[model samples]
Target chain A: MASVLRPAAISRQTCSLVSNRTALLQQASRTRFSETLRTSYLLRESRCLSTTQRKSPSRIPSNDPVAAPFHTSARRQILPPGPQVIEGGVNDPAPVPPTSPTHGSYHWVFERAMSAALIPLTIAPFAAGSLNPVMDALLCAGIIIHSHIGFQSSIIDYVPDKRLPKTRAFFWWALRAATVVVAIGFFEFETNDVGLTEAIKKIWTAKRKEDSYVEPVLRGVA
Target chain B: MISQRFTQISARRVFAQRSISLTSTRFSAPALITACKPLTQSRPAATQTVPEDEAYSILKAQRAVRPVSPHLTIYQTQIPWTLSALNRITGIILSGGFYVFGAAYLVSPLLGWHLESSALAASFAELPTAVKLLLKFGVALPFTYHSWNGMRHLVWDSGRQFSNKMVVRSGQVVIGLTVVSSGALAVYGL
Candidate 1:
C-alpha cells in the first residue's frame, strides 16, 4: 500500500511541474512577442494605426474589455503631449522674435499721450478765442503728427506686412508723402491765411451778406 | 396530534411573515431599480458612425494646422496693447471732431452766420467763471496728454529707454507731466 501511494504522489508532482513549466514558457513567448510588437509600433510612427496592429493583449485577461480590439481606437485617440505632426513631409516653421524691441513699448504710451494732448490743444483756443503764433505752430505740429500716426495705425491694422508685403511698403511710403503734402499745406495756411484758430473763428461767426449767385453765361449765336 | 400540527403551522406562519417583512425592506431599493430598468431598456440604443471617425480625425488635424489670427479674447491684454489701442481710439475721436467742426465752420458762411461777430464774443464772455474754467481744463487735458505721450514716443523712436523698468518709469513721468502741464494751461487759459 505504501509503495502504491508513493508512485501515485510522484506522478502527481511531476504532472504539476510539467504544467507550471509550460505556463511559464507560454508567458515568456507572449511577453517577447508583445515587446517586438511595441518596437514595431514605435518604428512605424504612423499617424493612423489599425487596432489589430497597435494593441497587444499582454497583461489583460482574454475576457477583459481592453483585451479586445473593438474599442482600441477610442482608447488610443487621446490628446498628445504637444503639437504632433502626424502628416508626413511637413516641417514646422522656426520661431521668430517680436519686431518691437522695447518691453512695455514706450512708443505706444507716447502715442496715446499725444492723442490725449490734441483735445486740449485744440479746444483751449476755441473756447478762449486766444490765437497766437506759438499756439498755431504747436497746433500745426500736433495735428500733423497726430493725423499721420492715426493714418499709419489704420494702414498697419489693415495692411499687414505678412499678406501684402510689397503693398505694405508702398502704402507706407505713400502715407509718408501724403503726410508731407498735408503738413506743407497746413503750414502754408498757418503762415499766410488767417491762421487755423482765427480761420475757425472766422467761419464760426461768418455772415452771408448776399444771395448765392453764378456768373451769367454768354454764348455765340447766329 | 392535531394540536401539535396546529402549533407548528402557526409558528411556520409567524416565521414566514417576519422573513417577508425583513426581505421586503432590504430589497425595496432593488425593486425600485428593477421598476426603472424596463423604461431604460425600452429606449433604442445610440448608433455610432465608426467609419466617419477617420474623416473626423483628418478634419481635426486640418483645423489644428490652420493658421488663425491671435484674437483679442484669447490673449492676455498688456499695457502696450491697451495703450496703443487707446491711442488709435483717441486719434479717431480727435480727427473726427476736427473734420466735423471744420466742416460746420466752412458751411456756416453759406448759412448766414457771423462766426467772428461781437455778439458771439460777448456771449462767450458772459459765461460763468466756473464754466469757463471747466471748458479750459477740458481742452487742456487732451492737449497735455497727447503732447507728453508723443514725447515719450519720440524717445522710444530714438531707441533709448527700451527696458521694462524704463518704460514704467517713463509712463509715470508722462502722466505726471500731462497733469501738471494741463492743469497749468487750464488755469492760465481761464
Candidate 2:
C-alpha cells in the first residue's frame, strides 16, 4: 500500500513541475516578441530619417535659389505606412501632393516693384492736370502691369490648384489675354485722343453747349 | 451525529482546496498583471475595433474627400495683410465710381442735363468753401492712401521691408505721407 501511494505522489509532483516550466516558457516568448517589435520600429524610424536626408539634396537643385526652400519636396516629409489593419476600416494614408515649382520669388518681387513705380506715375498726372505723351504711356503701361499682378494674386488665393485646378488655369490665361487687349486699346486712346488725364480735365472745364455730349442735345433742341 | 457532520465539512473543504490550486496558474501572478498593464495602456482605445453606423461612415468619407480651406478668421491680422486688403477695396471703389460718373456724364444730355450746363457749374461754384474742401478731401483721401500703400507693397516686392521692423516702419511712413499730402491738398487746393 505504501509503495503504491509513493508512486501516485511522485506523479502529481511531476505534473505540477511540468506546468510551471511551460508557464515560464510562454512568458519568455511573449517578452521576446515584444522586443522584436520594438527593434523593428527603431529600424523603421532610422530608415525614414536616412531616406529624407538622401532625397532632399537631389530634390533642391543648385540653380533654383528662390525655389529651394519653398519646394514641396523640401517642405514636407513622407511618413511610413502604418501597421496592418484588422477591421475593414478606412485606413488610407493621406494623399501625397505632386512636386513642382509653380512660380519663383522673383515673379512676386517684380509685381511689387511695378506697384511702387505706379505711385509717381499716377501722382504727377493728377497733380499737373496735363497730358504729356511720355507720362501717359508710362501711366498706361503701369496700370496694365499693376492690374495684372493684382488679379493674379486674387486668382491664386481664391482659386487654388488643389481645389479647382482647371478653373485656375483658365482664369490665369483669360486675365493675360484681357490685359493685352486692354493695353492695346489704352495705347490707341492715349496716342490718338488728347490723352486720358487731359480728356478728363476737358470734361470738367467745358461749357454746356461746347461739351461734346451737349452737341446732340443742341441739335435735337433746334 | 456531531462526528458525522464534522467529517462532511472536512471533505467539502478538501474539494475547495483542490479547485483553488487548479485555478492559480503561475502566469496569473502579480508580476504578470503589472507587465500587461503597460501594454494595454500604451495603445489608445480608438485603435480597437469601433463599430460605426453606415451613415456616420459616409459622412466621414465625404469630409475626408472634400476638406475645407482654413477660414480667414483663423489668421492673426497683420499690417501688410490688412493694408493690402484695404488697397484692393479702395481700388475697386475708386474705379467703379469713376466709371459710373463717366457714364452719367455721357448720358446726361439725353435727360436735358448737360455736362457743360452753366446751371451745374453754377451750383458747384455756389457751394460753401468748407463743404467743397471736405468733398475734395474725401475724394483725395482714398486715392492717396491706396497709392501710398501700393508703394509700400512695391517696396516689399523689391525684397526690402520684409522684416517686421521694416514693414511696420514703411506702414507708418505711408500713413504719414497720406495724411500730410491729403491735408495739404485739401487745405491749399493743390
> Highest lDDT among the candidates is held by which one?
2
For all candidates in order, the CA lDDT equals 0.54, 0.55
**Deviation in angstroms for B131 in model 1?**
3.1
Per-candidate clashes, comma-separated: 18, 3
Model 2 chain B: worst 10 consecutive residues (lDDT sum): B37-46
Query: Fraction of reference contacts reproduced per prediction?
Result: 0.04, 0.04
RMSD for each of the candidates: 23.9, 20.4
True contacts kept of 2: 0.04
Model 2: per-residue lDDT, tens digit, B35-89? Answer: 3322111111112454567445544443332213344555798776777777887
Worst 10 residues of 1 chain A by lDDT: A65-74
Give the per-residue lDDT digits (tens) of candidate 2, residues A70-90.
111112123221221223346
Give chain B TM-scores in order: 0.54, 0.57
Candidate 2 similarity to native, TM-score: 0.47
Looking at model 1 chain B, report the run of 10 residues with the lowest lDDT sum: B37-46
Candidate 2's DockQ: 0.05
